[model samples]
Target: MQLDRTRIVVRQRGVLDTLDLALHVLRVYLAPLMIAMALGALPLMLINHLLIAWMLPDADNLLDIPARYLWHMTILIFLQAPLASVFATTYLGQAVFHDRPRLTEVVREVRKVAPRILWSLVLIRGVGAAWLLLLSADRYGEFDSFVDTFLPLVLVTWAIGLRSFRPFIGEIILLEQNPLVGRDAETITVGRRSRMLHGPASGDLFLRWWTSAGTAILLTGTVYGTMLFLVGVLTNDWRQGRGMLLVAYPAAIWTVATYLTVFRFLTYLDARIRQEGWEVELRVRAEASRLVAWLVVAASVMCWTTDAFARESTDPIEAGRQALSAGPSYPWYDKQEDGLRPVHVQPARESALNRGSRWQAATEDPQRESSWGTSVLNALAQGLRWLGLIGLIALLVALTVLMARAFLMREEPGSDDQQAARGLSPLEADRIDNLPFSITQPPKDLLAEAQRCYQQGDLNQAMIYLFSYQLLALDRHDLIRLTRGKTNRQYLAELAAQPGLQRLLRPSMVAFEEVFFGKHRLTLERFEGCWQNLDTFHEDLQRLVTP
Candidate 1:
């Protein structure tokens, strides 16, 4: 019992330490992330300002409009906000949980992708502007009557366009930084490489985009509505209604949320593509389908309530007796005399039994009886059913998972003596368990071996070890596949072809490329750092690799 208690305490401490590290990483990366978002937003804001200046110069209420537009544009460009939260959450998540790249390294990589990000942003803004123009034309009745009748089509097309471009900016940023070369990229490549490698497929991209957009709209709308309700209540002045503010807030929030969601989805999608290839698309579709199922369930309940209410609002006796009685002879009803008979008149005691019988016969199921007050009751019940019960349960589950994950992603702090004695892996469990990390190699002893080879004047051997170590250990999975006693050049070439490790391995590989292949000298400090990283990487590998 004492030993069990000690173990529990140790586990708790481990979890707490991991959370602290994650929070620390978040603190370190938040500033640069905000800077990146701000940079992304600048052009969009400028464009919005230019549009306002050109189109609405004389409007006296233009100041607030610009503020709103700025908010919207910020969301459109940056994708998610509390911009600080996204940066903090994502960067920290990657650093703490996945050992793929350091915070600074990832930021540097993102910086390199800025041009691609900017181009995608420009394309997105162009699409938005074109949509606004079409909407304006529609409002002004510029189209023929037949064309006007297809307004829904126009709206759907606009929606599709918005959805399709939604992921591109983020996708470009992520892919540019983490380009999968060789087999890793090839395994995930779908369609004809010719077609898939170009612009995103309309159907698949739009599905993801629209699904993200819908979620953003729903979440933002709920938040906005709550705020509006609170404001209305607090002011006690419905006459000075700020309900319009709600609409504007959702639009602005939607812009930002859409961007964030798309970016997040793209990151996951890319990771999934790298891990499981085209199956990522299927997983996304499955998620969308689940959401659709929820919506369908909600809609079906509403429809049932509406039908019940329509039946209940009429006098029950009048609906059942008057409508069903007298058959063809009834003034308000028409029916063939022999084909249909009037409802049976029964004694009061037997009336309940007769009603039950008729109801069962009509419904074709005894269990599906509709109460007289079902309409109003069902309407109230539906809201309570979803919001009170289902929504609360979902919220609780989400919170639990987040907290659990946060706890799980901590390093177990202890002395090296204790770790070694306990046979604990040097690489923390928190560091190697989650995404990107799942595919990354643990830092190991390859650097030391490489250095020894360098000192021995076997420059090619040293280069191969360094290159393979960096790629197989730092960027890819835990496993290192060294060719069986192969020459340095052969081993390095083979390592380059490993799926999912090449892109991350490329930079360090480049460093070695010059040192060995170009016969350039490597600095002691740089070489030592690589060695240290390799030791840590080895520790990580021990944790990941099962005996």
Candidate 2:
């Protein structure tokens, strides 16, 4: 046997390390668990999408919007809850136990935990729905116009603050030991969840949750949104988009749901290791087992001593004498035939001359010791080879970086080429009469004329005049010397320098650009809103400049 001694040492890990281990574990299981969850949620998603396609009203149909939203809400609560519970329960099991999660086991666990999961979901969803109603109050005419913008801002800020220490309600369902059947468990579970979340390790727990679940939600949304765009493009039919979500929504569900459930499990373990001194407890338990073994041996020796004395005479003095006569029973192995025997290492019986010759033979043998390993020339050659490899790698990396820089830094087209291709760049100024839309406005009445064009259903003409009015106003206000070849951004920058005009017309310009050149469909609501804002700003400017 080769006598090569190697050792692997394990030590107690602190919060960050424990979390790192859990993250590595999660990474290994992310794919299998995701696959299982996606498959489980697939059927529900398909049904939801199919129903939505059949029942959802056209965007223009204001009367049916409320009914459509009600249908969506019904599906979200009843159907989405079960699908979510399956993913959460399954991933939690995998994270807690470090096992490859199976969909069948997930179903079994879901049955046991179903009520709690449903209640947890209901509480979360109910609060969110209340917030939605408050924010969407604009549609039903229940709140001031300002509330539409203000409430959503407040809600976003509140959500961000809440994430700092979001209640660990899910942890309650996962960690409770044989929790009571119904209401009692729910009450106790929430209390325990609160305790765990507020403990000393809560900061680490929140960071872990944000890093895993928060990031997953963002990435999942981006991936699914991109897929939806591609699918819409390939099919050339936006109406059939609902059917495509059957596949897409599963990917989204798999990412965010699985991450959130697994995060709860990791946090639970981190809290235990930090608060319970789990490593010390394990070492103490092992020492206790050793102590018990020694006690057993001591008691057996006493019994043997007492028996010997009893067989001879019943006196304490006699027991000591009998013990000496009986001698040591243990190690009892020495007295048994099959017991372990001491190895009596044999000494070399060879003479000094013979041993010397054998030693020389071994030292000279190439098989016993390689001269090449220690040779100066060979060592130099090996070092040179390693240096050569390193240089080659560095050269390849340098080349790659240089190539990327060159590609990015290539020269763009000239002003002449740009103007030739598109008449004028969006940034450039042009003749008033050369405007794309036909207009009946002199310079002084451009604002009133733009409004008339807008009222007459000529959105394109309206946006052009609105945009032109802003540029002409800025030029007269001496904000900048207008250029025939100026870009939209240059016009914006020129206006932004004037605090009065910047405050008034900056937003209007952006709205103008979106309508003037962007592909967004011009709806009546958006059209009216933009027109009113621009008109209000135009009126304010006239008052500001008119002395």
Candidate 3:
């Protein structure tokens, strides 16, 4: 019988399409998985509520209070980090495979890598706990104590944990699926040991991590401060009483602050994994279509659920009742010397108090009428105030939705033909084409021609040629004066001052200009030197000018 080589080739081709289809399915299903994850957390939230009730059984009117406040605190301690890790891992897997992973594939991958994820959580929590303990031990002046005792230790610990956890988890997830390393006990054990020590040993890593964390913290603090200022303005309650500020405002601020901080750290980890190929193992395990669906669904459900709960809990009637209770009250009735007084009428003329009542009414009624103007003004002012508030809220919602839609759309990688066919406008195409080191032909051809001219012992010709090339390379506005026969040194100086160009081309451009403008003589030696410099300049320029 003849060996059937074509059968083997056909089988391989079959698997390739199957994998692509699987990835497409995974991408489509990620949203639903995300929804399921949020829904899954609801039981845990209920349990937390039960625990809170058990702990404080005597507290009255508990149902009226929002459940989220209590559950959020509990979830943060037990569930938030793990959930975030899962989501981050899923994102990495999707990114690495360049397709959506199936939900079952993601879950299985997550299960296999769960130990690693748990280990990361342990490392983070351990470091955080230790830092908190050290902070608590310090009994110096308040702000100084926080800075000296807490900040340094926390910063160091966080930097170390982040650097280690990101690469380690990524490695575990990516490497877990190899046929050679498949979920086998011995391979996993070896992998775990390797992952435990992947963090940066150098000082530079710490500095980078610290700078990223510090910037995030500063931004979060600034946002919180701004929000508090806005709240103070809206409430018209400028006094910062510790009870109200600490219990309600500060807790809310801190929660949001921590969420943003963790989000930033996750983004940093993503960048590191993308740059370093740390997510290869996870990608191998990821089933594309399911994973995508899971992410999209989970995120969407969580957002919707949270929004719905917020809307339901914000009762306008309750708000109005609270506002009324907070204001002064008036008596329903009053008594006089003769009998029970009718608040709207004077006493009968037969009574001794009639004359006194008449005098009192005459004197005080005008004053009361004058005072009524203040009440009318106050009511009108309150009405206008609510109108402005309603308008402001509508405006904010519109802006938020616009921004969310702008940022949240999925962007898939496209083919070159597809991109070209989009046929962008000239200015837009120029911007895209000019993106640095993009491997298109214009800059490369220009540089090659300049190098050839320089090698032929025509220094003046080379300078003019390269200068003209530079003029054509720049945006139209930058080349306007050059085209008009103006050798504007100031314009060149301005270009030189641009930080990116300065970093890439300053040395070569400076040398070239000196030789071109009679500041330096051209000899065989100088020509060779300028040629070498210009070659390097061309290389840099090619990097800058290529699409």
Tens digits of per-residue lDDT for model 3, 104-195: 66556667656555454445444334334333533333335454445544544564565534433334443343222436322334333333
C-alpha lDDT score of every prediction, in listed order: 0.45, 0.53, 0.44
**Candidate 2 lowest-lDDT run of ten:** 1-10
Q: Which ten residues in a row have the lowest lDDT in candidate 1?
A: 4-13
lDDT of 1 by residue, 279-383 (tens): 433445557777888999999999997899887787665666665655546544444432434566665553444575744333334676788799789988998
Which sequence of candidate numbers ranks them by lDDT, best first? 2, 1, 3
Q: Which residue runs does candidate 3 get wrong by more than 4 Å?
A: 1-84, 95-112, 127-204, 238-547
How would you encode candidate 2's per-residue C-alpha lDDT over 1-547 as one tens digit per residue? 1111101112345545544655665577667666665655566555545444444344433233334434343334232433354555555644443334566666676567667665654344343443344434434344353544454445444544443465344455544523424373123345343443344455765676566545655766687677767876887654423333434555555555555545445555555544444444445565777788889999999999789767875677565456654677544335444344565678776665557575533333356454765687778999999999999999999999999988766435463464456444334324453333333424345667678978888776666677777666666666655654444555555565456666555545545545543433455664565566665666766776789
User: Rank order by TM-score, top first?
Assistant: 2, 1, 3
Estimate the TM-score of every prediction: 0.32, 0.37, 0.28
